[model samples]
Target: MESTSSEYARFLAYGNQLIEVHIGLRDLLADLREGVVPAAELGAHCLAFCAAVTRHHTGEDTQVFPLLAARDPGLRSFLAGLEHDHRIIAGLLTRAGAVAAELRDGSTADGAARLRQELDVVAAVLETHFIGEEKRLVAVLNAIDPSVGLTALTDQAVEFR
Candidate 1:
């Protein structure tokens, strides 16, 4: 019984770590959207944000999702949906990166506005994705065996800027 309790605690840690990453990403997006980063460095900052998000999704797709699917065959379809969301987010990131490049090159007078628009879309989609993922996966994650090395699931920590 003690072992089961310990495993439950570890599983909850995994969910908490996942939420922490999402919160960090949300904060970074808010910073970008609020113009907290100066124009001179906006391009670099935006690119870094995109990279961090990409890394998070890539880690989930490669490490976390596979493990979850293996643990519960019922989750395969749900995980597929999450993977689809990752692809959508990837496209949004690419668009954001392109706008950031334009801003860096000083090629567009309204580059900031364009970049902001792109980021707005990304934020909306991410909000939906993150909420849905947390709602569905937290319980499942908490039910998994703690001995399964859950640390590897979210080990690719996003560096907060």
Candidate 2:
């Protein structure tokens, strides 16, 4: 079995990757707001970000959370709050997705601005969610069922891969 700290270290590493992606996506949003990004680039980035977020949330909802909840009573209760945040973030992305499609089809400057605002909302809400998750659950995650949580995370990541 992997050491508890190692499993948590791996989990935090994944969280850090998402954080990096969000930072990049946030910069892309800022560029869109400033009208600095080429429309083609902006549209492409938005599509990629939407896809990335959907996959990330799917992994959490389907695989990771369930595994964590099995061993930790704490995690099960926290799922409600986490899922709520997920819904909010996903809605922001859905709205942002519409704006991206408009931009791709050659909408006006306001179209891009609208998407940028939506993306900012996603960034803010997701950042808070992610930070809370790390503080409240990341370390304890390793102590949850490693055979379950790690295996599920690995299997789901393969499916996602």
Query: Each candidate's TM vs. the true structure?
Result: 0.83, 0.71
For model 1, what is the alpha-carbon lDDT of residue 34?
A: 94
Q: Over the stretch 15-115, how does candidate 2's per-residue lDDT look in tens digits?
A: 56555655665565566556687756676678777877777777778766775675455767788788788888888888888888887777767766677
How much does each candidate deviate from the true structure in C-alpha RMSD? 5.1, 4.3
lDDT of 2 at 70: 57
The per-model lDDT (C-alpha) reads 0.84, 0.67
Query: Residue 117 in candidate 2 has what lDDT?
Result: 80
For lDDT, the strongest prediction is: 1
What residue runs in model 2 are displaced by over 4 Å at the alpha carbon?
A: 1-36, 143-161
Backbone N/Cα/C clashes per model: 0, 0
Extract clashing residue pairs from model 1.
Answer: none
Measured with C-alpha atoms, the lDDT of residue 149 in candidate 1 is: 48
Give the Cα error of residue 47 in candidate 2, in Å: 1.8
